[model samples]
Target chain A: MAADWIVFWVCAPISIGSAIAMLLQRNAVHAALFLIVNLFTVAVLYLVLGAPFLFAVQIIVYAGAIMVLFLFVIMLLGVDREERLVERLRGQRTAAILLGLGVVGEVVFAIRAGVGFSTRAPAGFGAANGGGNPQALGRLLFRAYFLPFEVTSILLMVAAVAAMVLARRRERPVASAERRAQEPIEPSEPSEPSEPREEEPVG
Target chain B: MLGQFLSHPPVELGPIGPELVLAGAGVLVLLGGALVRRRQPRALLLASLAGLTGAAVVSVSLWRWRGHATVLGGMVQADRFAVVARLILLGVAALALVLGHHYFERLGEERPEFYPLVLFTTLGMTLITAAADLILVFLALEILSLSLYVLTALSRRLAAVEGSMKYFLLGAFSSAFFLYGVAMAYGATGSTHLSTIARSLAGQTGNQALALAAVALLVIGFGFKVAAVPFHMWTPDVYQGAPTAVTAYMSAATKVAAFAAFLRVLMTSFQPLTWDWTPIVWGLAVATMIVGSVLAIAQTDIKRMLAYSSIAHAGFVLVGVSAATQEGIQSALFYLLAYAATILGAFGVVMLASGRGEEHTSLGSYAGLCRRSPLLAGLMSLFLLSMAGIPPTAGFIAKVNVFRAAVDAGHWGVALVGVLASVVAAFFYIRVMVLMYMQEPLEDVEPDPSIVPRLAVAVPALLTLLFGVFPGLVLGLLERASVLRW
Candidate 1:
């Protein structure tokens, strides 16, 4: 247990440091690579917490598929022209302070209330929500939470449709003549030839 | 007496037939869509037809099995209340689907995916009203929310993306609160089943603290879904930005599902803790009503105005919920059906009148609509009047029942505030009517003939009048179906 604690203590800082560094990095591609490393470290943290299922999911889902998709979009779009620096305007600092204070107050209140928490090392996940075993999770998911699971699939379908709609260009392009027709007409000034048009002699 | 007969257990499969039909229909639609994707148009048409048929079949089944009963291993127990709510959800989904057929066609987006999504979402709503467990409630909530997020952003337009982003972020955040609350409650009571939890926590230590937190969090989460005060920021943007057809579906269907779930959570799981939670709810109800109606009056954008009106109606429904009685639950169910019909009609009018791409939701665009299209204007006015809770409209009857429930519950302050808010709400509904009838035609005024919006307008308008003239038709059904087990 002491050894485990030592490993956790060592890894935690590295994980958090890498995450912050990844966010602060200027080079877009480098930041993404760092994010991959940071995500893997978080997966390790989940493993330390004895949640192997969550650990695997974290690595495979958050680090692998979702991030890859993110990177693909970012690379495909090419971030150079689109990255705009944001400036904090006046009174924004005050607003942030107030929000921070509210958060602090909430945390303090929770702490003061002494909400007994059970972070005790679990015998297994199954004991959590009436047998948190994966099989139980599956049963609960299919039998009790079946509707939400189905709805999620529909959401995915909608996402697919949105992607298709967003990606697909219109088949018909507007003709130049139509474009010109749609343009508002401006009154023409009587042709003032600045350097009187060079006289073309018929002779 | 009917419940006792059902409880006799020898032969009592009469009730819960609607839920079974919906479940059957959902499976059919999903499988059918998967099998025939290559024949896109036909598949899409078939999927929608299946959804409509399923909804109709389920609604009819519910009508036949009006007496209350539980089934399917106690996962779903339906009385008149659940039946009526499910029926409303089905009806709304049907109208929304009709509008969707035209909407997608006009937009040249004939994805069969829309019908399956709508079918599954409606199925989720039905399950929500029938949910007998805490886990089931949360699951149903997510099911509805997930579908709506997609539906809210269905348009693939910039506004849709923006609106959906706001909705998703806020919605996901609220869901976390709900989950946390559930976790707390589970920890406190060692059960996720509402009835079991109630029994376990009846005299348990720290039960008040845990139950209060759970109820509060659930309220906040459900409030976001229903467009109640403070959590209503997403309503206008999402409603205005989503495809009008999708918006109509969401407005009617989402509200019904959320209230059903909310009422279930409050009345079932927290019944013992009501005295601890009722005052807070009383405050939220009054504030939601006053804020929703009053703010609506100041909006110039038609979509935004309707969004505010939806919030106001949510408040009215909350009054019924806060009553914490069998009558209150029944009234809430009836009110949801009434509000769904009226709001669907209003959006149907907007969708019908809207140009292709739906860039004309501004109030000014509706000026002199009566002169251009008398039938459309007259229908729109009927919807608007109903929304304002005017007589001979379903909305009025819904509000009266809710108000009676509140008065019965001895929340006279809330009732008075509701009445005042109704008066304030009338101004905006009337303003829309005035714009349609009295104002001169704007320079760019033109009718875009689309079959989708027209049908959308027709069904809800006809139902509004039908339900309005015969209030007992739905209310009586509600009374017969209402189950009062807590």
Candidate 2:
């Protein structure tokens, strides 16, 4: 348990530091890297929390995929501006410090109050099914939350169409009134003599 | 085999027939929309309109049916409470469709997805109001929230995009807090089912600190949804920026659904912890009422003012929830119905007057409306009066019911605070009325002869009077609705 605490203490600074760096870093690519580090640390934390599935998901989806997308977007945009450290005014700096302190205080209070961990037995205890493992989640998805899951898919489809519609600029169709009036005198070869096309001239 | 399987729980399928019908209609409309590409949305519109009417019929059919029962193995509930609440919700959905049809037509932004989403969200809201389990409640909240997020951004304007983003971000964050609270409460107790929690917590002593913290987190989460003070920073911006029709639907249906869920959770599950939460709720209720009313008077924009008015109404509903009495629940239900009609009508008129681009968000734009369109002006006045809790308006009866319930619950101080808030709120409502009727025309405004918006406004405006004068009608329906078991 003491070893676990030492491990947590060591990882905690790197995790929190990377998170703050990710938010404050002006260079988008560096921010993405920092975020990946933060997410990897989170996965480590999840492992400590005995949530192996969540740890895997955190590493695979968030650190791997989402950060890659972030990097890709940053590279595609080609914005390599150097980090500009923001000069905080005295009042604003004080306000920021106060807000940060308040948040820290709240966290301390919550910890002191012992409000985070469960007193009762954790979910999936002595049960065949567990808390949202891949298989159990799949079964729950298909059986209980099937309708909502289907609806989410529909929402995704709508979102795809909406993105396409919003991004694409299609031209409006015009009747070309003058072309219709001036170029319409010609007729295809007739089998028989046809009456001349009548025109009513405007006054 | 399916029948035999479902019969074990003895499902109350009859009560949920309306929701099922709406759900089916939503899918049908979506399919019909895809099939009829050239004349897209016409068929969808017809189907959704038919669906809304069908839902109303189903609501009426269940009106005579009473008592509490579970449906779909406790995933959904249908009782006297949900029946009346759903009827109100469906009615608002129908009006919203009418207003949306006209608004979209004028703006040339008609799409088939809008109506179906609205109906589905309404169905979700009905389920939310009757949810017995915490998981079902969360799912229902998501269903309602996601649809509204899309609806808020449907206009695709700059303000709409920004407002929807803010609303979505804040809403998701609040939901996280709520989910965490649910997790903690479930940890503290042994179940996610509300009744089980209630039963488990009954006779359990000590741990007041944890219990208070749980309820506080829960309140913070629900406070955002209901737009209570301190968590209401998003309400005005979202309301002012969203399409007026969507705002109308949200202000009415969303509030009713959230309050219903809030009351059920508190009265059923958290009643044992009442002493810990009542004072906090009382403080919140008073603060919300005063701040909502006081701040509303300072707003120049009409939509912003109404947004604040909604916050104040939320306070009133919270008062009832705090009372934790059957009368309190019933009164809140009645108030919800009245407020739904009044706000919908008010927003309907706002939609009519604002034209394609919705430029009439400010209070000054309403000046000389009487000269421009007397019929519209009169309707707007009636809505304002109802909102102000004037006699013979549904708002008045609704407020009285809540006040009576609070008094009966021996919360005279809370009731007094509510009355004070109403008095202050009246000033702004009357201010709008005076602007519409007493002021002279400043600009040359053309009256838009759109029967859809007018009828939409008129029906609810008339209902406000009908129900206000005959409060017994809706109240009787509400009385027949059974509060859910803890």
Two-chain DockQ for each candidate model: 0.09, 0.09
Candidate 2 local lDDT, residue B332: 86
* Ten contiguous residues with the weakest lDDT in model 2 chain B: B3-12
Q: List the pairs of residues colliding in candidate 2.
A: B80-B481
Model 1 residue A86 lDDT score: 64
Please write out the lDDT profile of model 2 over residues A1-203, one tens digit for every residue.
78768878988999999999988887788788898889998889887765677889989999888888888878887867565566557588779889999999999888666644554444454253454455565555655554445545544544554454344332111223334455646577532256454343221
Tens digit of per-residue lDDT, candidate 2, span B370-434: 88889989998999999989998999999999899889989999999999999999999999988
Q: Write the per-residue lDDT of candidate 1 for residues B48-94, one digit (tens) a residue.
A: 66656666665566555545444443555665567667777887887
Instruction: Give me the TM-scores of chain B across the candidates.
Output: 0.91, 0.94
Q: Report the number of backbone clashes for model 2.
A: 1
Fnat per candidate, as a fraction, reads 0.07, 0.00
The segments of candidate 2 whose C-alpha lies over 4 angstroms from its true place after superposition are A1-203, B1-17, B58-68, B71-73, B205-208
